[model samples]
Target: MSIADRRRAQGFTQEGFAFAVGVDRRTVGRWETGKSSPQPPQRPRVAEVLQMDLDELDALLTSTGARPKPVRSAPSAYYGSGDPDEMIRREFLRLMALSGVIAAIPDDEAEALEGSGDDFGRMNGHLWQVYQLARTKGSVYPVVQSQLTALNDALREGRAQAGTLCFAAGDLFQLAGELAFDANRYHDAAASYSLAASASKEIGAYDLWSCALIRSAYVDLSERRYRRAADTLGFARRIALRGDGSLATRHWAAAVQAEAFAWLGDFGACEEALDEAEKVASLSGQGSNGRWLRFDGSRLAEERGARYLQLNRLDLAETALKDALTLAPLAAGHSFRRRGAVLVDLAAIGAKRRDSEQVMQYGLEALRLARISGSGYVARRLRAMTVELGNLGRDRHIAELKAEIGTLAA
Candidate 1:
């Protein structure tokens, strides 16, 4: 007999069964209709309500043909299991495939799920907080992966509203993209951002959609694909214009555009974009939730400094980077990464000026922080700085600093 048949034979109405199971009536309806099965935590309670053992409950749940497939083994971590890079990549790929499964279901059937989107919004908000507060970003991967799995099951079983699912998918995909990006998996980051953009567009979420495009542009920017990055940023800028102007989305797009222009060696265009980014200072609110839509002009100093440094404007770069260092938060992991980046830029300036003492002073400190934080972003900056030291005439201190940095990869 089906679950509903057993429940009714036991003289329990759907509402009564749901009440005893501590779930919503709609959730019971979904199980009865073969749309979804009980999660592991809910199984024992469900079995008790239907007067069955664990084995009988499993059989009943499986009879619906809605059981989730067993998880596949992930790729071996080349960097070791404890390495944040490997952990982030493995979790990101696993969740990406799971979350993408929602696209397989037909739209109309998917929309039939009962709950409002508020539950998902709240859960995502909490996850974002945990992400921002974590020491290592990879530490948040397990929770995010779990959330994605739950969302996937809900979407597959037609237990969530379609519009809500789209919004959640867009948000979750962006978060996944960030993890992939931090892990230096640029291709995976680009794919996740593309999925986010698609889902945001489906729901007319202009800000979310534009942010996805902006993030996708970063993948191109990192690879030194300046022209492609510029083109993508241009599209993002136009999309952000249609969003709430009171928000910082447009300015964030412009700020990132400045970086592209800097890389392209267009000093004039770069400055123009920087000026446009400064408009965020005049806005009323902080213009961000410190989560998905972060753009309060706090990073502008560092970004401007980085861009000017790219343009060989050492004086301007130093001044801006100093300001960023002063404003950066104290003793936070994120601050360590940010401060390490600015210090590396300063060290690069010292290298260009052929000042060995200045190079050692800044470079060694940045390298120490990179090792402490395990930040790939900071490590990459230090590697580039090492290449710049070749022009410094083989100074012993510079060589020592390079040797120290080499130990990071080991």
Candidate 2:
């Protein structure tokens, strides 16, 4: 029988059943119509209200053609035989589904397994290193997806401690959010960050929670929601204060706050925040957790440049961007997305100064990098630079540069 039939058999209307389970009547209607399944936290309450055990409820829920498909194992040759990019995308989606299944199980009922928390922790640490060192950030998505699957499975199967699971989930969610953000999926990124913050708060991981909030603020900042971003950053700063003052979390919050303030045209506040971020260098030990939290002020120069560019301080922007270019890794080993962003900012500076030659030089280089990396982040930045170029008139070189960028964008 379907869930709706079982509910009717038990003499409860949809609204009555929803009231018993403390969910909206629409939620019950959706469950009956196969529009959505009960989430993990709702499963126990749902089973109770239905007067059935978990297994019986599962069967009823699946009886209405709403069951999840059985997960398939990857073929022996899957890793090396398929088109590489397609393989990554397929595996990434599969792993994401696996995480969902794992998340759906209740902690108390999950069977205890033999995996150690340290094992998962170490593996996650290595994945973070791989991501940081990869040429294009997209290359890390598959690995992050896999790690998230494993971590979720471990948690659901009771192989990891509750606190450890929460911490790991928080970190993995942040990394997932980064992938989504770079792909220009702002809504997805915001959702992931919200999940991360929720997980971190469950474990009282102040630094992780604050970092998630700061990352969420970036989505708002990118969308030109300056006041909302500032509010988020301000809340993150307060959370960071409750943690280790010596950690980079507070400083990282300040750095992002600097950008938001610059966007608001609060030059004095921006500079003060930048100064706070710079103090991380004078402190000992870099203040990072080496895995999900690494803010040693390495990106400060580039960030300062971007902030200055936003504030229309072309002279300061040029100097900071030049220093950033020197400090950033070379083309062969560097992050294409990061380098492309700095180059785009330099092009903006050139456009502001009406230096056609400079604009072409930086703009074309950024376009080349964007094409090579296939980064939506770089493409978005290029689109913004195009708007900046509107005032540059009809110079032949500038027109040619814009045409090339348009082609790359297309």
Candidate 3:
């Protein structure tokens, strides 16, 4: 059957289907026209709205000759001179609205999950929907933050059940913490993580509790508080050991330990932790849904690259970073942040060699990616690289690069 036919079979008009799937109606028109195709990440939502599995949807599209062309990475040509703060805020609200609908479970059926009641499964799915929505856009923060406050109010008013409401509240707080981390607001991130940990503990959400601790450790790492970071991650690691040995919990603990050891300049311990991390990557199977398993060792590659960068092992650093760049999925919004980081490191190596062309090339790309993602963390790191690049002296291109970096500074 054709893609349109399948949607019609599912009782959705073109506009109705587009609205249901969170996309523009014209984009849907183009899809059905076979003029273009939805991106891979978008396909799952399309299937969900059509009430078909992904494979079946793909088959229908294929049968209708709806082929997707490759989308090449283009340099930022339209970095608008608009207020980024406003843009970020708008995007955040859009994501929150999306999350609200996606995260809602029917009130009647919501009570069945505890003690193998259906409520547990339903709530788990809803929590995961919120998590996935947050992962897609930085703009979801305000909505999540509002939800966190609302959940607390509900608890205070004694208007909600303890089990499901508490779990949902913890999940919302965790997403807020994640958004704070993304914005490079470490103090806010730390506070949100602390609240998430408390809520998770209250709800017996061991996985989420350990994850929150790992997040808190990242804040400590940002402040160069290595010893404190280690303490936080060590506590998480211990808790993870007693909590089902879930792949996500174990991998997160090992990844943070690797990062902590790297900061301490303990290469031996870092490598050992990395080895444990690799074991998690070697799991027999990963569920197809990426909602819960986003931490599958990609950052470990970045950590290795950063460690080598710190040790002045430029050759190893370059190799590791290139490996990280290869493993990072370009369409993943956060991958730009990672690639920008590695590029900055590589640019540093170019500076050491007096290779102005290489430095400009990599540094410019990093700057562009940082601004596009509004990644304050990457933007800060790139600003530091600008200072080192300055000693190169007397090039208009270098001057322009510095200008760009200045705009991104916090």
Candidate 4:
């Protein structure tokens, strides 16, 4: 028997079993998932909670359990028993799901995944960290989709912690939207963000809702509908205001709003929004969860530089971009994406000044980082940079840069 089967046989929910054993619920989940085992000190408690001798517990922990059949096979005589037509209908639907004609997870399997809010929180946070650090973002997609499916099951069942689970759903939706946005699938990203916003609103998670709306606005921003994005962001600002003041949600929203303002050539409005974003520095530890909201003020300089670059203020952009490169995180090589972005912006400044040498200097550095990280984000930015390099007019080195970037992005 696996730890999961033993725990369930003891008539304990995963969360309840963890409480009795005096460990975090996710620890039980890890144990059951065969990812980890209880330490020597904790084994006694775990054995006691499962009502088993220590030796039996050890054997259970080391053994695998039978996988449940997704569609149960009825007994030979069941066709003659109660409500045969209803049974037939249920079996047919299960068959369809099993055949991949429709999406569904077996009820038993889905039920086994239910846990407390902290479980989802810890899982989502860990997955976010993995996604952010992963060399290829697509590698994280399968697990996110699997988790989301299980989460939908939990929601459908309306479990005891429905509201908290809904918050997790909203956060996961935002993550899905991020993956889509990073791939430049604006339509899909917008749909995910909209669902995220709805989920957040259903649970009164103001900050999450505001962040979802801000992300949704990015589709508009990417489409070059500056006024529309700005308007959407204005509403997001109000939504953020209703959230916890200590969170950096409002500040992050303001920073993105600055971008729309910059693109629209409203210097005063852009400056005011930037000023609002600066307030994030006043909050302790940048008031970020490092998962759902990773503002942390680390990229504020880069953001300012990018906004200025958009407005073609090359000198101002150059100054901020250089400052961004000097930030502790970037200098220590902690953030590949941000550093690449700032470098690209610097290269664009060089292009605007018609200095091929300067352009090559920054562009080559950015290209090297992209190659190392294999990040879709860096490749996407490079795709845009190719346009500016084209305007630099027929230099051999420039052509090499363009070819390398195209191949990398492809």
Candidate 5:
């Protein structure tokens, strides 16, 4: 039997086994889904927790052929170790060429996307993966623009499945909005997000549709259109309620609503939304395969710090941001951009308090992390710090920091 099956037979729930094995329940799900193999670190523990011999556990997994190939941060030999950079360049060129050809074709005359409807669905899914890789590497704008052009052309030619095409279009526009928002191009982000919402609505992808709305609301918040943002996200909340509530959709809506409430200085509403967001903790660390669910409770501290910062409650901001800094992982992963933003906010609060030393320490560290992640959003927030610095002097340190922010210039 598989480990999951064996555990069930032994009368242990997946969660029960996961707790005993020192991993998230989603980790168990990954094993069951054949997306991961148990690491050496967990071997003895797995054997002990499941009451099986080490060799027997190994035999069962190996014989069932359910074990995943071990993952690597870098490309594997099975893909024939080409230079990663070179491979990326080649793939980029290939995608660009395809996009160019599709663009040049006359809309009514162009051939449809080749293959069955399932093939088109899979292609759309693959495009989402491509989008993710580009977003992660921090220069996705061009790729997304290219892909969007291709998809648009396909739709014009009637070459793509309507559902797949609309979903892909929605996703691409959302990414464009994200790229623009990170750059502090609020108006541009709002336009792209509007397009995204329309596309998602076309296909009835409620989760994606709500996500686009929430993204647009962020632009309003950044522009200090707090009332507009709150109104917009209220619509999003209703749509999210209709979605699968798998922690992702619910907590994401709650988190953004929390931000909007905080910005409006509605202390009661802000705390209420935050309390709702806190419920996400009960369902934390549950994402698999890097899905776009950013609502994990890991960012709760950071979000709280941001709220306090907006209120100019320096002591509270300091404590929350410090906790966030401690909880945030050192390596580049999901929360890197968020933690950097929190740190920048904390630094800004310090600046308001005339704590130059605190500003230097937190601001520099936040800048370093933001650059490493190439996060446009965090970089833009850092720009606001310059306004906060406000003639602190032509002091060499302040001037140097300004120059550094300039380097991140869109």
Candidate 6:
């Protein structure tokens, strides 16, 4: 969407949106008409006022054939170039699915590279979406490496939009860390997450920073360091609180915290966190967008089921997992990873009860899904069921299930 289109959709008049961007209404007119582009330092505010990520803002500017050109020669002339509209600084992003959070960018860092920062942000977001959809994660490495190199060079050379570039870099770092996590490279993932958190902190991107911390918690969780994971989640929850209230930043953190708390056997804390996560359903907006915020309560049921399973509450886990299975996202097989995880959980319940038939039924289906989707997450869950499978060995099917899980690829 172009700037005008996005502005109107977000319920902003030219004068109103541009007014918040600290630019003249005439400047917006020129931008939409492809006559002029916002100067570098002003682009961030423009993007924020439009209630969009830097990538989306770039789309609007680039769509109109507008290009940013830093006005280094004159300062007074630029500020007095034209009159802007009267608009409140109340963030429009709350309307953009990110609750009442407004970013406070240094009026200066919005202008760094000509189009590189936006390009990086856009490409990084696209790569994350692609990564989420792809079964095998390794294929995205080449492109990620290339983009990382270019972005790093740009970061060093670019000066004005330091914060913008850093945010884009942070987004890219998270994606890179996700890839490392998928490959089971825990150390590398931690490093990438650290970089992500640092970069995001530079820009005061509460959501982004919190997300990095959440991912870091996953590393500790994978290592069976429950205490460390809980600590990390505790920090993430605090960071998320500083972000836009409309976004699901805090809720997502709560969800993860719920999982961590469950692992710690803190039943009260887990329930409290789960209740907080469920509140996402009451939000007026989706509480997410094309950026890093993907928690919209769509997977809340599955999340609840997983938490219950962690706490060994089989009845609750079974009910919630079954409910999750009936949901469209799982029923239609939109996400094999999620579906497979649920199946594995169900199989674990069956194993706990010494129900061979039930174990074989859900376990086999989960194994099949793992093969079809090549999801390491599902594979890991399937492999974790080995201890449960050890409790039952009278049936040949149980032995086969254990063997298959052992042979699953990393």
Best by TM-score: 1
**Residue range 305-330, candidate 5, lDDT tens digits:** 88888777789988988888777755
lDDT of 3 by residue, 1-410 (tens): 77888889989898767655546778888888888777753564566467665556667777777885332222111111112322333443343343332233443333242223234334444555665544233555445544554555554454555555545644555665666566554545676677667655655656667777888898888768898998888888787675545456767777777878887988888888778777776665661124333677657777777777766678888888888777775665446667778889888878766688989878988877777777766776776676577567787887777666655524
Q: Write the per-residue lDDT of candidate 4 for residues 226-280, one digit (tens) a residue.
A: 9999998999999888777788998988999999999999989999999999999
* TM-score, model 1 to reference: 0.72
The global Cα lDDT (0 to 1) of model 1 is: 0.74
Flag regions of model 4 displaced more than 4 Å: 1-117, 329-333
The segments of candidate 3 whose C-alpha lies over 4 angstroms from its true place after superposition are 1-137, 287-293, 329-334, 390-396
Q: After the best TM-score superposition of candidate 2, give how far the Cα of residue 226 lies from its true spot, in angstroms.
A: 1.0
- What are the TM-scores, per candidate, against the unseen true structure? 0.72, 0.70, 0.64, 0.70, 0.64, 0.71
- Judging by TM-score, tell me the better candidate of 2 and 5: 2
Q: After superposition, how far is residue 123 of candidate 1 from its true place, in Å?
A: 2.0
Clashes of each: 0, 0, 8, 0, 4, 7
lDDT of 6 at 162: 56
lDDT of 1 by residue, 132-195 (tens): 6665665676677667666666666667666577778778778877765665556557767887
Model 6 global lDDT (CA atoms, 0 to 1): 0.71
Say which prediction, candidate 2 or candidate 3, comes out ahead on TM-score: 2
Residue 336 lDDT (model 3): 67
Task: Give the total clashing residue pairs for model 3.
Answer: 8
TM-score of candidate 3 relative to the true fold: 0.64
Candidate 6 runs further than 4 Å off: 1-117, 329-333
| TM-score leaderboard ranking | 1, 6, 2, 4, 3, 5
RMSD per candidate (Å) reads 19.1, 14.7, 18.0, 20.1, 21.3, 21.6
Candidate 3: residue 68 lDDT (0-100): 51
The candidate 1 region of ten consecutive residues with least summed lDDT is 73-82
